[model samples]
Each structure stands twice: as structure tokens, then as C-alpha cells.
Target: MKKEYMAFLCIVAFLCIAALLLTGCARTPEADIVTRKNTEALTDKAAGGTENRKSLAENRKQTPEHYSWKYNNDAETLQISADADILLPECEAVPMYRLSSGGFTQEQVTGLYDYLFQGRETYRVEEGGLTKSECEKQIVRLRKQLEELEQQEQGDGQGDDDWFPDDEREYLQGILDERLAMYGDLPEVSQDKKIAVDSTLMEQTGIDEREDGRTYEETTHSLECQTDEGDSLYVESGSVDTSEFSLLSYQRPGRYTYSSGIAVPVDPGNADEKKSENLPCTYQDARALADGAVQAAGITAEITQVELLEGLAENGEDGVSSERSGMYSAFQFQYTRTFEGISVATTASEYVNEEEFSLMWPYEKLRIVVSEVGIQEMEWEAPVSVVETVEKDVPVLSFADAAAVFEELTPLSYEGKIEKLSQGETDASMDIHVDAVRLELMRVKNDGSKREGLYVPAWVFYGTESSTVYTSDSGSAEETWSETEPTPWIVLAVNAVDGTVIDQVEGY
Candidate 1:
């Protein structure tokens, strides 16, 4: 019995210890359980809170067609509606607080109207509401107002830098004043009389046309007319009295008729006379005749000044040959005339020793002076050929041959220093000088296959102390040579397929 009792006690103690250990492992802390339960409750409340509440009014408002909602104060409910054809009832104007229900507020309605109807021509006001003249006047007024506002914005203390300079502003004002003065006035200037001289008629007056129908060669007289204003006009009205002037024909030393049908007369006696005569005009006889004709025509003209211009020799003193030889002469005569308080100057030039002996006189300049009452004088240097020579050794090249050679040799990439020392042509050959040349070749492959080649020609120039290289590629490669050296370098050719180099030459 004692043994049984001891064993039983040991078992009981072991069972008790086991129970305590299990209880200790299975039980959670009170504080942790409270924390977990509280958290779960808060999450539940949050999930079911105000955010989950949906009203019919709000739902209707979310639809685009309905797109409207209103709060009813009397009914304490929100109402909403939507449909494609539905129209909201228009609200009467009311205080902000009173508009707590129905339709939109004034501001909201205005915004809606603006959003829907802005920039659309469907809503037009009225036609002919403003006349064009009234509109223009309003525009001018608005512009003036805008200008004033701008001036005010710039401030009074600002300088006149914003406006035109004084001289320009004054000029503009004067122009405006002149324009205003012309508003109701006749044109201030008269149209100019442009008389086109008939060259055929004028040619009939020349000594060469004496055999023509007109008997200008048989009479020698002058006519004068007096204008109503007491102005006198003189005209050469008489014929050339050829019967009194007998032909004293004498052969001249230098006289010759050219194949061009021009007759040039040179008499030894006349040559001595010409030598004795002052450089340009042999006598004042021509001027006297002109004056007499003017007096006969009743045109008031006074000779104010006369000048003699020298002639240029057909060949230079050394007689060097040139292309310009015998083309023109340098001798001329200038005369100034005053008429109707206007001073006009004119020049008459004679081309002598040329195949064609030509004479040119200025009549337009004289007319302009007479009309404008202003002194107008013009002087020009006549071009004369002093030398006559043919260049014997000048080189010439055909365009096609030059282009072909340029295309062929330009592709060869030569390696060396290049200096353009000289370029010249001889009668037979053209000469080109280059100091150095360089060329490089590059092989390129595409898609793991060698399809194209690249050529680069580079040149170093001694004159410019620079170097340049040109690249040429396959398919699209072209060869070009240029006299002007490239800086750094330029791509001369590009390959269309496989992008391979064809030719490249560099120059320095």
C-alpha cells in the first residue's frame, strides 16, 4: 500500500507540471487580445463608413446626359435626373442662400452657357447693328484710348526714346500736312511733255539726205517767231543752198573706204589744218550756226560755256596690238546753254579714225535743263584703245574634255604634299601646279559580307599650310576636283549600297 501511494503521487505531480506547461503555451496575453479586437472593430467601421453611402441624386449626376443635381431644403432630399433629350427647368434669379435647391446658381449657369456655346456661330446677335463708318470711328477711338493707356503705363518720366527721332518725326508731320493740303486742291505739278523724236525725220535733216524730196539743200534762210509772252523762238528754217557751195574735190593721204560701207576722208592739207586747229573743234562755225538757227526759230537760247575734249589715237604710241583697237575715239565737244532761266549743258562726241565715223550729241540733257531751270552738267571718260596686239600663246580647252579629265583623275588618291603653285594657259596647253598629294583606301563590309570599297584622297597644300581629305564610296561614288581647298575635309562621294568607299582625295 505505501509503494502504491508514492507512485500515485509522482504521477499526479508529473500530470500537474504537464498541464501547467501546456496552459502556458496555449494561452495569449490579455493586452494582445484587446489590441487585436479593437483593430478589427476600427477596420469594420472604416469599411462601412460615409464613403460607401451612395445616393440616387449623386448617381444620376455622374451620368453625362443627366449631369445635374439639386438639393431640396424643404424636402430635405437631393434630386437628380439624366437623359439625352431632357432639359433642366430654368431657375429664377434669387439670393445665394435661397438657391439652395433646384437648377444651377447664376455663376454656374453662366459658366455652363459659356462652356457649351462659346465660339459657335449658331448663336448670333444681330446684323447691321453697327455701321461701317461708326465701327471705324469706334476703332479709332479705341486705338487712341489704347495709345493713351500705353503712354500712361510707360510713365511720364520716361524719355522720348519710345517715339521717332526729332528729324524723322518732323518729316512725317510735314508729309501729313502736305497730304492734308492736297485733299481739295488740284495737282501741284503738271504732267511732263515727253516728245519722242522720230529718228527717221531727224535723219532726213542730215547732209547725207540732200537728194530726198524735201528741198532743204536748195535754200539758206532763217525764221524767227515771237511768242505771246514776248519769248523769241529761233529755228533753222532755210535749206542748205547747195548751188553756192561747189565741191572742191581733192584726194586725201589717209582717206579710205572700209568694207563696212563707211567712208573716211583724210586729206594731207586737212591734216595740217587739223593740226593747226585747237585740239577738239576746228572752228566755232558749228556753234555759230547753232546759235543762228536758235534765233531763227524764235527760241531764246544763250551760249554760256564751251569746252573741247581731245581724241584718242587708234593705237598706243608704241603701237602694241589689242582687241579694242580702232573701236572708238576720245574726242568730244561740250556746250552749255541757258534758256528760260534754266542752264543746261550738253556734250557732242565724234568718233574719228574708226571704221565708222559716228557723232553723238546730248539733246535730252539740254531739254531737262530748260524745263527744270537747273544747271546739269555730266562728264564721262571715253574708252580708247591705246594698244593693238594678239595674244599668241593663250591656251584653250574644250568643256567636255576638261569635265572628263576632272572626273577621272580626281578619284585617284595620291599621297604627297600639294601646293598650288601656278595655273596658266599656253596657246597649246594648260598648265596646273600642285605641290603634294595623298590618297587612302578603306574596305567596308555589310551584313558580314564585303560589298563596297571606300577611297579617301587627302592633300596637303603648301600655299595654305592645310590638309583636306575627300571620301568616295561604292554605288554612289563620284569624283570631283575643286580649285578652292576644303577646310578640315569634305565628303566627296557616298555609296548608296553597302556604304563602301569609292574614292577619296585629300588636299592640304
Candidate 2:
């Protein structure tokens, strides 16, 4: 009886414990809703992770770690793949001649003389007292008109015989003559020495024919001259086309047509003779040639440094290229206009493989293409010196601050097919490498006029902005996959300066 009672109590305790467990296991409606919400949140997270697989590198601003930000140190350079397929049509480069005794043609002399003189004409306008003189003349004419009107009224009744009124007519005519005598004539400036030298040049003019059928008539002309005040000015130019060959083709946007690839705006004529002999001369020789041209033209600019374009790089190159078997045919010289040994800022000067210029092309320049023989040709801007120049303060932006400007995202666009890089990147959007930073002096003209410019200091930077183009497309905005590299189009001179951009082509 005692054992049965103990078993019943144990059974009751077990049943109560089981009942408590069942109560704990049971779920309310709120609990079930919370579980469902947690599961949906996890599903949303997974969907977001699946949506964003590929990311764009350009979305973030990039700064170069490899380049020195100082000009005195190593500068960064970029390899720019040129769309050589495009060429400038109807564009002719000025031919450079060996500074000979022969002088400029009559037309050349007259044109330059008039050009500079015309520039000074405005200067004399204010000084000549012409405005006051005109006012006095206008008053005198008014008096004469009134006198004539009174005489006509008096003669209205009289016949033709009395119409003259000789005494009144004579008095009025005398007054008019006196007024005319008071008016001073406009001023004229003469540089007799320059004109005398020009006459000598004209006497020595001649024409020569190249081995090719082309004939380049070279006549010495003063590209620059000086006045009594010692200001350097371009007062003369020659009627000469000293190039050894004629242009066979031209390249531009959309299409490029050339007679021969060799004529690729490189050395136009054949250079068979120099191929055997040590082809390339020294940089010293190149510098001498440039100085000679400047001296011949009477320009005041002195080239401080003459750097050779690298065969493979932009900043600097490994020793000199092989003279005979190099990619270039001649020594190209770039002259950045200077004043008193200080460098002047030029906008459209790209002196690389060859000197070229164009309003249509983004970065055009005036360059001299020289060979072993001498200066082959020149392409330059018609730059004129200011009669008066003003100085401005240096830019407020610091070097590092200017560098930080690149950290901001900017849009880059390109035309035509691009080069294919081993690393797959669409060069359509460009990434620039900050190579060299410089705080240098530069000049900008006022009111878009080539004359009366201002000299100011700016932080100039040089670098390569790279880009890639696509031959085809794949994937949507959210998801993308590409196994093959896309075509790339890139142009450097992501220039490359500071201060106000006065013109389209801004370079240091």
C-alpha cells in the first residue's frame, strides 16, 4: 500500500513538469510575426548582396603615388596613343631656311612694316591731339555753313552775277583755310636702320631646287626687329617655302588620307644620305640651329633648355635614340617664348614629333622640324609682343592645393578608336597621373587681344590622362562581364597649368 502511494505522487510531479514544458513551447501570434519579419529581412540582405557584384574604379577620385610633385625632381610622363589616322587638311606649315645673306621679298617687308606700324597707330591716336583738332574743325565748318546760308539768302533776289558776293566768299574761304592750317597731320614712325637692312636682304634673295622635284624659294626676312626704344618686334617675314617636298596628304577628324605613310607629316623628303652616316647630330647642334634661327629672325627669346622627345616616354628618355635606325627622322625643337630669360606662357604649343598648330585640334603648337641638313620647316602662332605689359600677383592656390584639385571627379571625353591596353580598362574615361608640379611665370593677353598681355605666376602640372574605348558592349548597369579587352583612345596634355584659362589651348 505504501509503495503504490509513492508511485502516484511521482507520476503527478512528472505530469506537472511535462505540462510546464508544453506551455513554454507554445507560440503566440506576435512571436510568429517576429520570426516571419526576421526571415524577410535576411532575404532582403541576400538580394542586395546579389545586386552589387561589379564596381567602377572611376567612381572614386584617384591620386598618383608614384610621381614627384616638384618640377626640379623627377616628373611623371604618360604614353599617349595618338590617333595618327586624323590629320589637318588645308593646313600649311611655314618652311624654315638657313639664315643666308639673301633678304625678304618686297611684299614680306611691306607687310611686316605695316603690321607693326599699324599696331602703334592706336598709340599715336591719343597723343596726336587729333580729337581736339577735329572738334575745332567741326566748329569752323558750322560757321562757314551759316555764312554761306546768309549769302544764299542775300543772293536769292540777285542774279548769278551777284550770287558769288566776292568779298564775303573770299572772307569765308580765308577763314576755312586758317582753320585747316590749325589741324595737325597724323604722326608717322620710321625705323631707317631696319629699312636699310631690309633693302640689303632684298638684294641677296634667291631660289633653290631640292633633289626632289619640289622647289623651295627661300628669301631672308626679318621675323622680328627692334625700335629706338629697344623693344623686340616681328617686323618682317620672307616669301619662302624651303621644304624639300610637297604635302601629299592630310589627316583630320573622321578620316585621314595620305599619299604615303612615310609622308606622315614626318620628314617629307628622302634622307638616304644621312641613313649611312651617323644620322642624328648632338643636342648641342640642335640648340645651335634653333639659336641661329632666332638670331636670323631678330627675336629676343633665348632657349634655356633644349630637350629631345623620348622614343618611348614623355618626361625623359634613355640615352639618345639610335641615329640611323630611330623612329624619328629629324630633330624637332620647341621654343617657349620668353622675356628677359623668364619663361612666357604659351597656350597652343605642342612641340613633340613635329611642330603643328590648328584651331580645331585641342593642343596645337609651333614647332621646327630639323634634319642633318638644317631646319626643314616651322609651324608657329602669329604671336605679337605687347606695346605695354602689366604684371599680376601669383596665383593664390598652393602647389598641394592645386594638386588636390585633381582629386575631384571630372568628365573626360575622346573621339575615334582607342588603344588596347593589356589591363582591361575603357580608356574612354581617363585617369591622370600627376607627374610634375611647377610654380612658374606665364603671360596672358588682355581682352583676347594677342597684344598688351599680363605676366603672372602659376602652378603648372604635366601628366598623362589615360582612357579606353569599346569595340563592343556587354551586360547591364547592375551586372557586367567582359573577357576581352576593349579598344582604347587616349590623349595626354591633361594640362597642365594654373590661373585663368584665357584661350582654348592652355599650356605652360
Candidate 3:
């Protein structure tokens, strides 16, 4: 049960992230991706107190009435609903392009440094050494935790520290002891504070043979710096295979958990009565801040998702005690690459050899976390540089044909997994319902030795899956149990040009 509960929680978080990626929309001039809004029909229906006359028309525009797939046998059932539009491009054909990563120039590195450290006291940090200020902050945080633990042990049963397990007391003490020792031996800050460019950071790490017989290039270039305000910044450009991506993180030592952890928005429906109790900045404000940060980093992409970082409340369950206060902390935005005004389809799953794929080709994404105070963190990973166009106006399949391909391959993607998961149940069934189908660019690797790939048109499917089970005990009627999870996954990616299914993880 414990393992199942933990798995369920992970599944929920995965679905939440996937849903945000597919449905999130923050249009920029560079990425004019379609955003359909049927507000007029909704308003008309509300005014008339019934379904509006144009409801049918709007539904037609959103999804086709037919093309659903269903299958049933003794063990389970698979039902796929093609309830979303096959949003194809306006042009007759979509072009494919070759992509690769390259090294960063000295000018580029200098410019990035200037932009990141402008108007701030920044000092280049040597590798493997802790700063005096950050060290002191850690010591303070550890001491405070020890103090809280001690007080909790001596307090009445109603104290908030019940969530702090008694067994971890010794562990915290060990960490505090180490920090105290380190603090006494740390060096003070010097007057020479100007950052010097580490030329090695700009060089490309050529192919390296690993112990597992796999070869890779260390494409990431990184630098660590300390600010006068006790904040530390660690920036990395490029990734394991290339140097075009960027990552900037601001770490405030000993930050309160409630101030810097994963969070979701408060219920907007209750915002009126709970205005003062939730996030201070509105969505618009957060969006503007996020745009500015993206522009500062010189990134050209589309905002795929924006989420409010409203802290979690301490309800007796879920390990959070009521003593832990909740408040609005930050805003997180996810961005994806765009090609010729079309956003590339993105996914978390990698369907190939993990080590090889990561070292050669990985999905690119940009994420920014902003707070009322300022931008907390920014990351752009697995960036690609377009080398050339493989084909201009490449003819592609029609939506009808693509739908045919979607129906054919989706089952194969989930074939054995469903049966394996429901093996022990007496009476078990499953439903695979697809809610959205998108026409987007998919990166497929060029069959060669070098790190190169082509971005081709593919039809990506997204939706949910659910399962039910009925079990009986001795002399008792059967009890029903069920689990439903969003499958906003790239269930299958059908090549628009050839109707062949593209492996999302392998990039081919």
C-alpha cells in the first residue's frame, strides 16, 4: 500500500506537469501558435440559460465527430477518444531542418557575464570552496533546526514539530557539527572582486569514452559566483552535447522550505474571499516578469506553461503539519522551442538508451521561476542550432490519414504495460482516452555517426488512462477499486510525411 500510495503521488505530479505542457499558452510574436477561445459561445449560452445555437459549430471546429477507437477482451478494454482537433499547419507542406550544438565564443561568454552580474557585486568562486557568508548562513540554519528539534522533544503533544521524525535528530546534529567545523576554517572575502573569464568554460569537451563503452561530449560550460547579498549564482551554458543552452540559478542560503519548494496556485474560484490569503501578484504581473527575464537571457521561445507557486498548507495528512504556514511564493513558466511560427512538441519520456540519447540528443526546454521579489531561477537546456533545411515545403499527410496512423500505433505504445499492471485483479478493465491531437515538429535523428537530427512534422497524441478492479473476500461481496491518471503523454508520434510512427525518446 505504501509503495502504491507513493507511486500514485508520483503519477499525479507527472500528469500535472504533462497537462501544463500541452494546454499552457503564452504566445509571443516569435511563436504565434494557435489558441482557440470560444468565449462568445459560452457567453451567449449563459445569457440564454441554455445551449447556444453555435455550440455545434464550435464543437465541429474543435474535434471531429468520428474516428474513435475501442477494443475489449476478457482482461481489459482500450477506448481512445479522438475528442480534439487535428490542428494542421496552414501551408501545403512543412520543412525539415538539421540541428547540432556548437561551442560558445569569448564575446558571447563576456556578454552573458555582463548581463547576469549587472549592478551587483559579483566574485568568481574557486571550485571546491565555500564562501564565508554562505557558510555562516548554513551554520545558523542548522543550529535553528537543532534548537527546534530539542524544543519539540520537550514540548506538549500539540507542537508543530510532530512532522520532524525523532530518528532524524542524530542526522541533523551530525550535519550541524560538520558545518560548525567548516565555518571556523573558511577564508574571508577579498577586495579584488572582478570576475575573470575561465577560458576553459568556453571550450568544447570533445568525445570521451566512458566505462560503460558509451562515448559522449561534455557540452556544458559552468561558472560559480557569490554576491555581496549572501546569494550564490551558478550558471551553466549548453548541455552534455552542446553549448547553446543556458542555466542561471540564484540560491539564498538556508531559505525557508515554504519559500522555495514546489507549489501550485490557490483556487481562483475562491480568490475573492481569500484575496489577502493567497499570492500577491496576479497572473498578468507574473507573466510580464517572466517575459522580461526571458528577454534578458536572449531566448527566443514560446511559453508553454505558467503556474503560480502558491505554497502548500499543512493539513494533517501528506506530511505537512498545520503549523507550516502557506503563502504565495513564486511563479514558474515553461518554454519550448519554435520553428517557423510552430511550437515543437515536447515530452518528458525518453524512449531510447538513456545514456546515449542524453549525450547525443535531448529535448530542449526553458524554465523560469519568478517571485514577488524577482526571478528566482532560469534554465534553458539541450539547445540546438539549425544547420540547414532538409526540404522546403515538404508535402505531408492529411489529417484523415494521420488519424488512421494514430489509431494504429497508440495500442502498441501501451501494449504490455496495461496487462502487466492489472495482472492480479479478479475483474479488471482499462480505458485509454485521447483528448488532444497536435500537428507539431518532431526531432528525428539522422542515421549517422555524428550528432545531427532533423525536425520533421509529426502528429502527437495526448490524453488520459484509467483502470478498475473488483475483488471479493471470504463470505463478502466484491469491493470495487479504481485509479485514473492523465496521459498527456506523447502516446504516439506519427510522422506526417510518411505515416510511420516516430519514437519520441530515441528521436527517430
The candidate that wins on TM-score is: 3
The stretch of ten residues in a row with the least summed lDDT in candidate 2 is 245-254
TM-score of 1: 0.14
lDDT of 1 by residue, 1-508 (tens): 3454344345434543554465656432211111111212322332221321222233224323312221222322111111112111121210000000111122322332222223222211123243444444455544555556566557862465665444444554565455444444433344333232110111123343332334333332222222222222222222212222111011111111111111122232342243323223233443443343333323344442232222222355334333232321111122233322322222221211111221111121111111011111112111111121121111111112222222222222121122121123101111122221111111111111111111111111111112232334455664333333311122222111111122221100
Alpha-carbon deviation at 170 in model 3, angstroms:
16
Order of candidate numbers by TM-score, starting with the best: 3, 2, 1
Question: Which stretch of 10 consecutive residues in model 1 shows the poorest summed lDDT?
Answer: 93-102
Error of 1 at 454 (Å): 75
Per-candidate total of colliding backbone pairs? 55, 14, 1
Tens digits of per-residue lDDT, candidate 2, 447-501, equal 2211222334333443344443333334633322332211111122111122122
lDDT of each: 0.24, 0.33, 0.55
Q: Judge candidate 3 at residue 455 and give its lDDT.
A: 75
Candidate 3's C-alpha runs over 4 A off are: 1-74, 90-93, 102-118, 127-209, 213-220, 230-233, 238-278, 312-329, 350-352, 355-360, 420-431, 448-450, 465-488
* Candidate 1 off by > 4 Å: 1-283, 290-298, 313-333, 340-363, 366-508
Query: Per-residue alpha-carbon lDDT of model 3 for 243-347, expressed as tens digits?
Result: 233544555322222332344434434323332333456666666766765555554567655555544455652345334444545666777777776668876
